[model samples]
Target: MAGGFGAIAGLLGRPSREPRLLLVHRLDERDPGDPGDPEDPGAGPPRSLLVTHPRAVPSESRGGHTLALAAPLTRVTNAALAPATNLDQTPLVRASRSMMAGLLSDLDHDGRRFGLGIDDVLLSLLRGIVLEHPDASRTAPPEATTATRLRAFIEARHTDSRLDVAQVARELGISRRQLHRHAPDGGVAAMLAERRLATARDLLAAHRALTVAEVAERSGFGTASRLRAQLARRAGGTPKAIRQAASA
Candidate 1:
């Protein structure tokens, strides 16, 4: 994570909270033969445009007031930034940036807090990059930590009620087959339903002011009757009983 927005903004002479218009150019992978000596400059003016999306940052990275790309995106990005000796923009890079812009915009307008949704969009963008540049994808380490990523995404968007495996796959820039491959024990749908139930349970137990209908909608259960049925099936209790117990 970066130190803070202040440091970055200070360099740009802008307010810490405001977006900074920073430029990143002249990127090259570290070469043993090239001592990185400024005097031995071989390349002309740098060609890459590095635009920071102020809304795409994760929670932890947000604490440091810095923007960060997910791990999968990072490797592809590094690969894209490397091997550049000229200002020539590759098709792959252009596509990735355009996808990135759309992802940022979607997450911002989707009325969900930043978390899994953001990661999903990023993963989807990474998937697109891989399609365009298979070699770049292969160069990065294998992503085997789908459990954590999926959990986070579910937790963030379970309230949408429309959240599902196919929607998630679309947002993550992957196919339904790929999504199943990353599914946890019961599968993505099961996991999402479980999360919604869990959230409803908590709301019922603690928030006396929220009616069962309100709890159901906010927790993504959609309706009180549905929330009641699920609660009886999985939680073995009614919303009223849960609230009474919590109050007592």
Candidate 2:
């Protein structure tokens, strides 16, 4: 989230907020992305930012913002901006990228209101990428905590109403202690409930005819009454009200 759009409107839409135009060149992890000796970050011609998403950002480097998103990064050739080149596309890669774009679109980046559900979607994509390129995946360092990984694991299976932390821990090959050590602000249960609620709202907004009962079932709230209870307790509204608000 830049203070203003800057030149990002032509590139990626505020990075944390919108997907970038991969026009002139595609982003690569190897691109030279150092903040330089004194961190002179200004909006320059062809400004490059790096996500290094999910990696632990240093505490001191955050400046004043609670969350800091580095600029976008792109590959270069011969010390010059590289031109776009053709590359092979696969369904796995395409689906991974498409989900990422959708997830980015759904989050409120400028407001810094990134919900756990979005991280759930992101971690799943990361694991999928590991499968896509086992060689490169093995070379990178693993995330220090399993909190985000748990989000992905639970999200991929959240539709199964029976999902519990214990089962998730066992499947992920980690102890429950590790799971809760770096849990999100409200912890796992809260994250799951929020995720389900988000899904329910999306279903309602997209399908005008979908009844509360249907949304509840698909979103894994199991029963309509349970869904209603959670929605009332957490969202302060009924399913119909949420649906209307979303569509509005």
User: How displaced is residue 97 in candidate 1, in Å?
Assistant: 30
lDDT of 2 by residue, 2-68 (tens): 2222232334433453222231112221123444444544322222212233222222222231111
Runs in model 1 lying further than 4 Å from the true structure: 1-144
Candidate 2 — what's its lDDT?
0.50
Q: What is the lDDT of residue 68 in candidate 2?
A: 19
lDDT string, candidate 1, 1-248, tens digits: 12354353244443353223222222332222445668766533323323244333233222322322334223223222222111134555445444544555676678544543454555555445445544322232355355545555675577777777889788766788877888877788888788889888888876677788988987898999988988888778899888888889
Report every candidate's CA lDDT: 0.55, 0.50
What TM-score goes with each of the models? 0.43, 0.46
User: Which 10-residue span in candidate 2 carries the lowest summed lDDT?
Assistant: 73-82
**Number of clashes in every candidate structure?**
3, 3
TM-score of 2: 0.46
* Winner by lDDT: 1
